[model samples]
Target: MTKTEKTKQFIIEKSSVHFNKIGYLGTSLRDITNLTGLTKGSIYGNFENKEEVAKAAYKYNAKRIGNKIISALNQSPSGAINKLMAIVDFYKNNWSVIIETGGCPLLNAATESDDAFPKLNIEVRKSFIGFTKIFEDIIKNGIEERIFKHDLNIKEYASTMVMLIEGGVLLSKTMADKEYLNISLKRIENLIHNEMKL
Candidate 1:
C-alpha cells in the first residue's frame, strides 16, 4: 500500500476499538491523535473529517467481527445445523471481547446512529442485511441438501434468527447475564432442529 493508504489503515486500526468502545459521539479527535500518535494534519490528510474516520472505524470493527464468525463457520465439520450452532458457540466464547469492546456493532450502530446520522445508519442497515443474507444462504443450502424441511421459508427464518441473536446480545449486555444470550441461542437451535425434522 501507498504511504497515505497505510496511514489511513493505521488510523483505522488504532482507533477502531476506541470508537467501538466509546462510540462516535463520545470519541474525540484528540483521542484518535493520542491513540495513533499522528499529528492533526496527518490524520486529517488521511481522513476528510472525524465523521469519516468514525464511519471507517465502525466498519473496521464490524469487519473484524464478521471475520471471526466466518472463520468459526468455516471450521465446523458438521452440516448447516452444526455450522449454525458453531456461530452461537463463537458468540458465547467471544462474549467478553464483544461486551467489553462495546456491544454488537450492529446493535451499537442501530441504536446510536439510526436517528441522527444518515450515512452511518445506512452502513449499519447494509451490515444487518448482509448478515441476514448469510443465514438465509445457509438455510437455503440446508434445504437443498434435504437437511431442512422443504416447506421452510429461508428468508423469514433467517431474518428471525438474526433479529433474535442481535436482540439476545443486547439483552445480555444490558442484564449483565450471559445466560440470557445462551437461552436465546438455545431457542434458535431448537427452532432450526425442529424445522429440520419436518
Candidate 2:
C-alpha cells in the first residue's frame, strides 16, 4: 500500500482497542497519538478529525470480532444447526476477548451515540440488524434443510438471540462476572435445542 494508506491503517490498528476500551467521548486525539506514537499532524493528515478516527477504529474492532465469529461458524460441518451452535460456542468461549476492548461494539455505540451522534448511531443500528439477519438466514436455511424444525420462527428466534446476547454482555460487563455471560449463553443454547429439537 501507499505510505498514506499504511499510516492510516496503522492508526486504525493502534487506536481500535483504545477507542473500544474508552468510548468516543472518553477517548481523545491525544490518546490516539499516544497509542499510535504518531504526531497529531500525522494522525490528522490520515484522518480528518477525532470523529473520523473513532469511526475507523470502531469499524476495525467490529471487523476483527466478525472474523472470529465467521471462523468459528466455518469449523462446523453439520450444516446450519451446527453452525448456529458454533456461533454460540464462539461467544461462550471468547466472551472475555470479545468484551475486553469494548463490551459489544453495537451495544456500546448504540447506548453511547444514539442521541448524541445520529449518524454513528444509525451505523450501529444497521450493524446490529445485519448481525441479526445472519442468524435469521441461518435459521431459514436450517429449516429448509430440515435441520431445524419447520415450525421455527426465524425472525423471532434471531431477534431473541441477539437481544439476549447483547443484554448478557452488558450485564456481565456491568457486574464484572464472566460467569453470567456463560449462563446467558447456555440459556440461549438450551432455548435453541428445545425450540429446534436439535
The global Cα lDDT (0 to 1) of model 2 is 0.83
lDDT of 1 by residue, 115-149 (tens): 77788888899899989988988888888788889
lDDT of 2 by residue, 1-198 (tens): 999999999999988887777887679899988998999999888888888888887777777887888888778776776888888888888877877777888788788787887767777877888889989989889888887888888889999888888888989999998877778788888877887754
Q: Which 10 successive residues of model 2 have the least lDDT summed? A: 117-126
Q: Clashes per prediction?
A: 0, 0
CA lDDT of 69 in candidate 2? 81
State how far residue 112 of model 2 sits from its true place (Å): 0.9
Candidate 1: residue 192 Cα off by (Å): 1.1
In model 2, pairs of residues that clash are none
Question: What lDDT does the true structure give each of the candidates?
Answer: 0.88, 0.83
Residue 68 local lDDT, model 2: 82
Q: Output the worst ten-in-a-row residue range by lDDT, candidate 1.
A: 189-198
